[model samples]
Target: MNNNLHIITADTVREILDQYPLELYEIIKNSYILHDQQGSINAPSSFLFFPHRPESRIIALPAAIKPNQEKFNEISGIKWIASYPNNKLKHMPRASAIIILNHPDTGFPMVCMEGSLISATRTALSGIVGAEYLYNKDKSCKSLGLVGNGFIAKHIVKYLFLLGWKIENIHLYDKFSSSVEDFRQYIQSFGDLKITIHDSVSTLIESCSLIAFTTTEKIPYLNDHNLFKHKPCILHISLRDISPDIILDSINVVDDSEHILAANTSVHLAYERNKKDASFITATIGQVVQQKQTIPKNKTIVYSPMGLGILDLSVSQFVYDKVKKQDLKNIENFFPS
Candidate 1:
């Protein structure tokens, strides 16, 4: 194993991604394909919870994406990520993470990268990718409804631009009006979309052809069955906002059914409510991508990826390659060999 250890900062990671955004999306999509081909090892995430603050958690997600026909190099890593909602009260970012990529052959740590941005970027791209595949119709959306206007929503909107998604209108809703205005201003910089801030979540849901839930809800609150009457493709990114009845009534596709159906997610709750029956979940996003599963007619389709770690490792590998090409410094002998 190479003894050289490299440390990449968040600014560098973000800068590299901003320059080559399409590459990030392609790698993530390819990672999904890798997992689908049975060429990946995705272990269930281990959550570290605090007794004093139940809302906060640190998750260790470890995965490996093996070499595939997509020319994706083998990558293995773990993302040590923490989400502390209380951090917001202290004016800190609610989530912070670090990804460690190990050498595929030797299993030695090769790179340690700031992972919050990587996490957010992969999440944004993966959701859109699955949204496109699960969507039976055209790729271009008329209007996208954002249920929560936060950091992930910001990343989603940015990637939409990067990938040239021709969304003519954007309807947004947030529990807090301050965040609504803040996100409105942030999106207005894009110039060209009709921005509508809805006082009601249902109005936003009813208004758009595409909808994304990016909230931090720990429980199922939105039980309205009428929200999907328009048959919009829902990007259930936050995972727990929709109710069991809604989930059962919808056409759901997930990155991995087993991983997502655990952890008491809305789908998990649905499984529990229905005596652990998971037939309601139609297919994995890979099945949708490979056209193995037919996306049917006139039902609300939901794409919820359980945040795969292989994608993190893939993106980190991308960043590592770019950093090397640019001749960034790696601290030799940092491992005390």
Candidate 2:
């Protein structure tokens, strides 16, 4: 284990984004490994045991490789992150977290850093990658239907702007009224964009060419009757926020089929429990980006990413490397040695 540890914070992440190219190559690659790798673990609600409830969730995600790969075992302590949604506090973020990068063999602590930014950026990068493959830029993409208004949602919208997507029309819907309003004010500084708060899920999703579902709901969001009939819509299922019937109808593109099915979110698990086949899935997102297959024309495509550790590790690594280079002479010392 490396003892020369480095920590990064939300401010550091914003600084990194200003110069990090926001490139999707490494993000997309690590996302595939995280989705395909079997040993990765995720328990989203482990923090229910905590006394103070701030809309928090805990995740202990780890990944290891068997000896067969190189006649030796290797594991990584990529992250043990806690996401607490309390950004409303003055000078505080919606999600606050720390990640410990440890030695695979000795189990020694290596680096601990602010993970809220890492988590948020990696999540948004997944959506950006999905958009790159799922949506047709030539067809005049307009208006984005964002389902959840959390930290991750904000990054998704930010990346949409980065891709030259016009946000003249943004429809926001969340379970909490204040949360929706919070997002509206939070994003107003990005650009001149029209924002509307939708009272119903149907109202938010309708008539939008590009849609993103990033909620924490266990079940699908849209009902059977309200399914999108409009072909060629890009559906970025950041979380399991689509109905089983919708999953059944659309050309499903997963980051990894095995990982997504294993996570057992919504219809992905339902289809498995009943022994139903998933032959309709067009292709994995990696395959599409790698040119293994092309997204179908005039079809409602869905890209569901089962947030993976490799993605977390990759982003964390980026933050770590960048922070190490700083002289520590210019910024506040938020992360202690």
Candidate 3:
């Protein structure tokens, strides 16, 4: 079999997002198997950490096997996607990653691809998927309140726009006014989107039917108003962005309970600290989309994505294939033995 490595850039991802739908679905499908490992430190000032360090790495490890052979043809592959944001300010990129595609049989490296866009797009599409399953297609949703304006928020807005969700009103509240203003200008380039700067998060949450918490905040700074009960909204809690009380009050759906619980990062930590059972997790977003389970419309639904490796691998696989077709490459050898 012909083997080669590929290097994919941020622009490559934009092209992928622009053209391929089937490949996108495949990536989302495979992402289900990977896991998330967000954690924290007790050091001075305290910090949240998602070390792609060792063990618990959810390697996609894809392969092909011969029918009658005792051993199968194996390929080497490992994907690592991780991120950390301290405050809503400082212009921090949410996630950075390195995806290793290798020869499994020979234990040699194959290719390396840029994972930032893959990570961002896969994550943003998740929110789109959430909107698909949770909200009725006929329902009119014009106003959206985004709690934090960060890297992830940009993509979420993009997907929402792509889905034909004529976002007539955009409400934003970030700790830094500059970030929020910058995001508004970036998204405004898409079209004549009505943008409103919320002096307070509470005002924004109350005004819009849909809400997204794409912040690095440790807790929800909003009032007691449970907006989830009002309409089918998305709480895309990337970090510990919302409060434990909010989590308990809302309908909790996640990418993977096992992965989230294992990592004990973000909202998962709140549940872990409160000694909540994993069974309490209402549903996995895929299962809901696939109709494995049903969630009530009356409840506020929050989808916590752990940013699994399968997502990185799935998108990286696409980049690898695209690079091969164009004859662009990054060489990494497998089976050094």
Candidate 4:
């Protein structure tokens, strides 16, 4: 197998991931634990912004998870992903990506797999894990609000069900009415859930106990602190959606404080507004997951995950391992020496 490497396609990646939804959650959870324990080298993502089209960007995330004697072998990889918000208007996906994994022992590239699915799946899992840790799971969430009706929102809904969240109501709001309608119909197929489409963001925000913002907004738009009542759980998945005032008023949590603070995210903005003080960032998800930090329940909780590269590595490695076991026939030779 020295001369051969596998080139996994998007369809295969989706198939494998769909087959083991719970396993994907566990993989992401363990990866977060490993990340908290400092078992991984997570480099900051490099951004390539378009000057002409300022909304579009391509990011390079390089990461490596240290070897574990019992669980995972040493692995290093990079995910090169691009985001073009206008692609939706052109009737295409907003993001596309590929991951290249290097051999641990020899530093030779061993796998090249389609990474968009991995990216979405891992991201969705991260949000769910944050909710699992930060949200009051014992208390039932009757209404779920999705601020953006996009691919990431859809995946979040999918994994929420996979994780057995008994959400009876789903409130969806999008700038585009067509996207909201499509999302409403898609979630309706799941059955036993009430779906409502809202024309305004504030209306949707007020309707749900668990709210998720998955839009492409680069700056803070939701600034009103009083809009958040009843100590709801906010999944700040899109990073920059919430204003710093809201972040300051809420109990803040993050995937990584340092990484998330660098990208001008809502958390980053909060840091900036507060004279670069980081006391507002209460704890990382790893700390919460490990029970090292306790998130107070009296205030609204905002989880801002910067979308770690280590997570991409974990999910990509999982896909590679699964493909090797079940679909050997699809393997391709990268260097046929």
Each prediction's TM-score versus the true structure: 0.95, 0.78, 0.77, 0.96
Candidate 2 per-residue C-alpha lDDT over 1-337 given as tens digits, one digit per residue, 9 for 90 to 100: 1334455566776787656644543554544544444434433322233557635666666643332332222435556666554545554655666776656566665567767777777778777777766786442356778887877888777776665665568888898787798889977878677888889877666757688877766555565544477754555555567666667777778766655665447547546644767676678776777677887755577778776666676666566667768843223343354
lDDT tens digits by residue: candidate 4, 1-337? 4877768898889999998999889888888889888899999999999889999999999999888734566899999999999998899999999999999988778888999899999999999998888886553578889999999999999988877878878999999898899998889888868888888999888888899889999888887877887778999999988888989888999998899888789888889899999998899999998899999989999999999999999889988998888765334456756
Q: Each candidate's lDDT (Cα)? A: 0.87, 0.64, 0.62, 0.88
Ranking by lDDT: 4, 1, 2, 3
By summed lDDT, the worst window of 10 consecutive residues in model 4 runs over 327-336
Q: What is the overall TM-score of model 3 with all chains considered together?
A: 0.77
Model 2 stretches astray by more than 4 angstroms: 1-4, 24-26, 29-56, 64-75, 83-94, 103-107, 137-140, 232-238, 273-276, 327-337
Instruction: Pull out the clashing pairs in model 4.
Output: none
Best by lDDT: 4
State candidate 2's TM-score.
0.78
Give the alpha carbon lDDT tens digit for every residue of 198-217 in model 3. 99877787787777777655
lDDT (tens digit, per residue) of candidate 1 on 1-337 = 4678888998899999999888888888877877888888999999998898899999999998776446678778899999987786787888999999988788899888999999999999999897678763365887889998888999999998878877889999998787799899999888866999999988888898789999989998988898778888899999999998998899889999899978879999998988989999999988777878888857998887889888888888889999988766688887766
Candidate 3 Cα errors over 4 Å, as ranges: 1-5, 21-26, 29-76, 81-94, 138-140, 219-232, 262-267, 332-337
When summed lDDT is taken over every stretch of 10 residues in candidate 2, the lowest stretch is 64-73
RMSD of each: 1.6, 5.3, 6.9, 1.7
lDDT of residue 16 for candidate 3: 66
